[model samples]
Target: MPDAQTPQLAFHNVSFAFDETPVLRNVSFELSSGETLIVLGAAGSGKTVLLKTALGLLRPTQGRVVLFGADVTAGSEREWFDIRSRIGVLFQEGGLFDSLDVADNVAYPLRNQPLRQCPEEQVLPKVEESLKFVDLGHTLDKYPSELSGGMRRRVGIARAIVTQPELMLYDSPTAGLDPITANIIVALITKGRDVRNATTVMVTHRFQDGEILAGFRYDTAAGGLGLTPDHRGDTQTRFLVLREGEMVFLGTQAELEASQDSYVSKFVPHT
Candidate 1:
């Protein structure tokens, strides 16, 4: 087992390409346990590729990916099974099974590879608890098609978190939703982070998403997000901006806001 000091995820001078076309170039970053990284970029900025590479879905053409303190850039698919089981991912658009009900979807990890040994008796309760965690406890029987877009996204979140993963990767969780719904999704994400103390990496194009992750925390007593500017150090949120497959900036929200670079400043919302 890796020592506690190891970064939960690290990409060292990583680059990825497809058929001679480069998508990411010499990208690198580290996310410690309980810290949150918000990746911002315009469409096709390699944000999704970066997230997938971190998850070992795509091998790097050059460089290394360290997970839990072990190098896994060349790790085989079978070898990645255990590593992946320890992480949770919420893909774009709530990637739920249209054929399955919410309960079945959330219970999938427990009954599948790497976690397949989980007792049958524990599956339902685990599913229920995960759903409740996302405020979707009553949607167990609902299909993805039956739920609203926002609710489906909640189910996606519940599924991502059902494993109580040590790492959570969210790919554009708020993409395609109304502003109100988007905020709600982000609040749930905040609640999950504060409640589980899970390390998180979220990829989004919206600057507000990064702002919320940096400036707010889940208030357990109030059951919602609360301003925690005084606890900024404790929050540990950072922003990473990507442009055309390259990392253009990596810093705190304040630093991001203060950036003078034209490209980086474009992602910073103007008051």
Candidate 2:
């Protein structure tokens, strides 16, 4: 079991290389439970690589990755299966099975459990509950082809949260969508963080998305999400900016904006 003060996820001097080309160099960070970490970077700056490393899909060439206080850097696939169950990943393209309907897509993880068998009767309710959480209960019977890009992303969110994962990883959940749809996706992410209280690490190229997520809070009493005026300091949400395989900035939104680094300052103002 993880200690009370153990970070949900931690990277210790992690580095990776594709042959001679280094992808991540000396990356280090810790994500505590109930906190959201937003990673921002330009293309090829190792944003997605960070998520893959956390998921154990790509091993670090150097250093270690700790999840729930347990070293997972060299863990076997069998070990990884247990670790992965407690984490959820939402890919950029909403990687739902084209043949499966919304419900089935959401139910895939539960039904495929290797350690414990889950009956359809038990799984069906979870599917419904997950879809409902994303406001997609009515899309249960609809196939992926029948859903719009935004709807597909919503279903992806439903699928990701169905297991009520302790940690959620999002890779550009709002990419390639209109402002309205992107805001909707952002709201769902907020709901996951606020309502479900899941730890999150999200990668995005858009600074506005990061700003909004860090600035907003789900107001249960008000029945809507509201922004923290002036996007003031939010300790719950932190930013990590990478530039060419190195961490350039790591701080709260206010600190990020206050950064004087040439790369960070240039990137923040335009984004």
Best by lDDT: 1
Q: What would the per-residue lDDT of candidate 1 be over residues 239-269, giving only the tens digit for each residue?
A: 9999999999999988998999999999987
Q: What local lDDT does model 2 show for residue 193?
A: 81
Model 1 spans with C-alpha error above 4 angstroms: none
Clashing pairs in 2: none
Per-residue lDDT of candidate 2, residues 89-185 (tens digit): 8988899999998889999989875643668788999899889888888998899999999999999998888888899999888889999999899
Model 2: residue 173 alpha-carbon error in angstroms: 0.8
Q: Report the C-alpha displacement of residue 193, candidate 2, in angstroms.
A: 0.6
State, as a TM-score between 0 and 1, how close model 1 is to the true structure.
Answer: 0.97
